[model samples]
Target: MKNLIYLLFVVFFSTSTLNAQDFSDIDKSPMDVTIIRNENHSPMARVIYSRPSKNDREIFGSLVPYGEIWRTGANEATEVTIYNDMTVMGQNIPSGTYTLYTIPNKTEWTIILNKKVHVWGTANNYDPDKDLMRIKAPARTAAAPIEEFSMAFQPITNGANLLMGWDNTYVEIPFKNVE
Candidate 1:
């Protein structure tokens, strides 16, 4: 009787502790997103983009600052790997990966293009001159927190539009198909 009670107690306590641990990333993660494109140029163009939800303790500022280069998001900079040339904001961007940054404020934020791609955000190897484009867009407030950062393309007449919105902000960058 004593041995049976002790065994059950140990098993139940251990199971409860393990279950208490936060398994937040079990179903949802930053890597999960809908990659939309209008790649008719043959091999299919690709662009990688990400939005962050909780940064450290705070949402935007603490994890992602107002005036600093964020690795786009937590862990590493958010990456957008492109397989071909595309025009954004009326400028031609060649086939390569680029790190997307934003200057966030109450109303508007400017999107950035740094030539260096596939690196951690805030790695400090960025050059402003290599920036292919900068386009300003409006940020909209949301009633609730967006648990996941997301990026997707909306089809347009001339090209595919990269629409980004999360945590009360939105931006659109048009990627014109390279012809």
Candidate 2:
């Protein structure tokens, strides 16, 4: 009887541990990171954001709305870390991590880099006073619709253009390294 009880306890504890170790379901909007390197292949800047799928719904103007500030991605506010000083749209931005925000319009989008970080969804937490710089980037229609929101760095002669697209709209923010 003692041996049987001990065996049962072991099985119960093992089962409980296994269940506890199980992971939860994947996030609906998964996190993604995109990094850009300099001429020597050294990291220049990185963007950490969550990609939310279109799911057959209207993204811009309807779901996201126009002339309103967007967190630039889902879940936590999108973060941009610059390893060195860079010029965005001819405006100088120092090396640091900043929250990326955008105001999308049909003609163009206002790209904002804010000093705030570690913020959740932008409900009442966004403060305009913390903004470091704001630049306008023209919005263009992509040939194909992107199912998921995406960001990529397109290499240029001096630096790289940070491309962002979702649904059918796309925008590019140019970043030039300052020597």
Candidate 3:
């Protein structure tokens, strides 16, 4: 009886230790997902990205330089999934997954949809030859400053507008469902 009890205690402790896991610290720029659904609640579009905080520092034209391609988010490249055929900026886009890249400018932003997916940040990984679509969206000053990077969908008569805001700048990209 004593031997059995000792063996049981040893097994329990060993198993408990073996089950212990070491996880990394929380990310500074946390991952986020925004999805736009149809009237029937079926998902139409989705964006997965990391939100980096402003941290009271200059964001545009400084931290994220202008006239250059940005990964569109922190850490990994932003992923956009389209569930149906849509028209953006008068250009047609089929249902598929793509990496979202952008070029920030004071007056407008050039939105890019690339064929590549699952890429890390845009450190020499972005290829213009692989670009599926490029559209220009006007940038405007926000009513209030945003502390963190954000992406959301606003419903419209045609389809939905993908609104991106960071710091004091915001831009809207419309996605119209193709009949």
Q: RMSD to native for every prediction?
A: 5.9, 2.5, 2.9
Candidate 3: tens digits of C-alpha lDDT, residues 1-179: 99999999999999998888555677999999999999998989999999999998999999999999999989999999999999998999999999999999999999999999999999988988999999999999999999989999999876899999999999999999998
Please give, for residues 66-164, the per-residue lDDT of candidate 2 as tens digits. 999999989999999999999998899999999999999998999999999999868997899999999999999999999999999999978889999
Off by over 4 Å in 1: 1-29, 39-44, 49-51, 55-58, 61-63, 123-125, 142-145
**Relative to the unseen true structure, what is the C-alpha lDDT of residue 14 in candidate 2, on a scale of 0 to 100?**
96
Per-model C-alpha lDDT, please? 0.65, 0.94, 0.94
For all predicted structures, in order, the TM-scores are 0.67, 0.88, 0.87
| C-alpha root-mean-square deviation, candidate 3 | 2.9
Ranking by lDDT: 2, 3, 1
Which scores better on TM-score, 1 or 3? 3
Write down the lDDT that model 1 would get: 0.65
User: Candidate 2 at 57: error in angstroms?
Assistant: 0.5
